[model samples]
Target: MAKDILHMTYENSLTFAQDLDRDDPLRHFRNKFHIPQLNDKDVIYFTGNSLGLQPKNTRVYIEEELEGWATLGVDGHFHSQKRPWFYYHKFSKEALAKIVGAKPSEVVSMNNLTVNLHLMMVSFYRPTSSRFKIMIEAGAFPSDQYAVESQIKFHGYNYEDALIEISPREGEYHLRTEDILSKIEENKDSLALVLFGGVQYYTGQLFDIGSITAAGHWAGAIVGFDLAHAAGNVPLNLHNDQVDFAAWCSYKYLNSGPGGVSGIFVHEKHGDAELPRFAGWWGHNESERFKMKKGFIPMSGADGWQLSNVNILSSAAHLAALEIYDEAGMEALRQKSIRLTGFMEYLLNGFNLGDDVLKIITPTDPAARGCQLSLLVSKNGKAIFEHLTRSGVVADWREPDVIRVAPVPLYNTFEDVYNFCEILKKVIF
Candidate 1:
């Protein structure tokens, strides 16, 4: 039997929002973004896990750069907009460092996701004859898998010999941290590196990076994270965690446009470490980069990782997004996220859609995940997904089973959650 129908009134929503907004330190942040529209109405968008809505300031930022390019030409590299292209990446470093909790010297914005992954692999994936295995979560993003497999082959090792995957236990939706640590211990002698997403893309499970790094170190292996789904959505103290290195794309939670420049974090400890890496002219010492020297003398810090002159348009989008993050602050954003996502969970459970019909696979513990909830629609995941799309609920569907909904706190509100729940109830009924 269905429970009582939950009638939502505008006043109830207003009251609930009033209380939440009263305590919401980041409530004012809603005005900072550009919400999308469908049929002249703003659809309830809950898919920041896939692509974040644009920031309203994005166009202004891009136009400034475009105007500078038109007015100053090559001179724009040194003197054009208030933010010079020559040092444009610098403006975002302080803000990016704060988001991932790293020193300014440790973070730099550069190429796209796959490209950055390949670059980091060049530096970190040193597989020896004896210790030649790399460990990653079983269901890693396909692009990451391709990059890792190609790297293994490039190093003259068979894929089977070079990769070790930690999978969920039978019948379990999530992996236990203990199990991951156990796997590290068992393969200690053979593993060269432990690399996995800071947050699993499909499951939204935030891996325990600190503990994972500790275990990998105990096993005499280097540890790193691909934080595409984790960065900006959760608090990641990469510096304090002391991980070897990490990378993340800015398009998702960071709210940069599609295919925006990505970021990399190289712990300050490795600032001067002589690691074999694929270098480019851009990585050369700044004062001498234009001198056309015979040999590569890398810049002193993470900036040394750059493989090319910065893409100003992409970097401009990131700069625009970063300004919002700096103003709102990650802690303040995360506070609203907890309540927004919690409210989503509350509404989802209240649907009383039988467990056999649909189930949330993301971990229930707040500490173990970010803003996303991956719902496994057991009956007709694709059809339900189509219904959602047609109904103007912009959620995304993963193959075979999941529909990911992320109520990003930067712009989402209690009303969005309530409206989404109402739509979901109608879809199920």
Candidate 2:
């Protein structure tokens, strides 16, 4: 697509992204998605950390369910051999469990991301007047901040007194792990819960979930994560890490459609039906769900946390995306992610346009970040972002002055990274 192809794959070669793509075992997975095209050519898509590309099979999968709904209507809930709407959430259970490293019993596919977060907090954020503070990253996604604030206000506590927000140090873009642990210790006396994104959305910093969970427990506070940016993009062991609860959206790296059904993980220890959840029929025991009992007899594990029936259409889309994940597997995907993102980092560092061009604010250690690299642009940041978009690169531009590009492993090639860098260099100069 470049007029000067040499600069694209030659002058821009280092990690020799082309060779890396040739060697990638997961290279074939790229063919599974529908890459966005402009002027009869695919865009250099780097926005999987924001919204993933649609799978080619996604429509086929969705059509099956649509046909069932068209023919069977009400009967599709129980009689559809393809996938019963009655037990729709079951289809995603195993795949989601594998993605997040939890037992099948601990996961459920339901509602949207923010809805699941609020649902999870209802049972987990039990605050007493004595130990009432909740800890979170200072600049969390607006939905999370709003949820926490509303939940606190609902409990008759003021935000200033009840919310403990951890911020990055001066001249820094991400919070230090040691600082997070220290704050957990300092707030332990009055902290009721500790919650944060598994990966910081704007900064692309991957928090240490295991360490944070341990510290939160030691502090006598329950710990949870919002995995909007981390799920399916990184490897997680939610169960082994002893994270009390978590919720994630399927729209991003999970590649489910817009507003796709979300997933929740409640450690098996919280499996008791009497754990004070806001429940509904879909979360009732399978045999008794239709009994229409006077009281809610919750299903075991995470399903017990569901508040309503499965959002069937959205869940169907989720099932479609998860099938791909189940096939590629998170382990293989994560290995590719490290290299793909690393390739982007290598090219960014070598761009040589000087710091005035831009500086990556995302963590340097691959382990401390997901696929996203947040570039803090010091000059003409928005204009450069517009130029990249015009050049057929799909990335995110966060307000003020930051651009986040995630070279997704599932479909992005090393060649894509090379072209992106070449175009970026030309634009900056």
lDDT by residue for model 1 over 1-429, one digit each (tens)?
011112222233546755766776777788888778889888888888888889999999999999999999999999984988888778899999999989999999999888888888888888889998999999899878999999899999999978999899999888999999999999999999899999999999999999999999999998989999999999999999999899999999999999989999999998778988889988888899888979999988798888899999989989999999898888777766777777778778777878799889999877788999999999878988899888778998898888999999998888787877777878878
Error (Å) of candidate 1 at residue 30 is: 1.9
Expressed as tens digits, the lDDT of each residue in 1-429 for candidate 2 is 123221233335745677888888999999999999999999999988878889988898888988999999999999988898888888888899999999999999888888888888889998897999999999999878999999999999999999999999998889999999999999889999899999999999999999999999999999999999999988999999999999999999999988787889999988873666677777778788787878777888988877788777777778888888999988788777777777777778886667666899999887898889999999999999999999999999999999999989899998998899889989987
The true-versus-predicted C-alpha distance at residue 185 of model 1, in Å, is: 0.6
> Residue 278: error of model 2 in Å?
1.5
lDDT of each: 0.87, 0.88
RMSD after Cα superposition, model 2: 4.4
**Cα displacement (Å) at residue 164, model 1:** 0.7
Overlapping backbone residue pairs in candidate 2 total 0
lDDT of 1 at 73: 96
What's the TM-score of each model vs. the native? 0.95, 0.96
How much lDDT does candidate 1 score?
A: 0.87
Q: So what's the TM-score on candidate 1?
A: 0.95
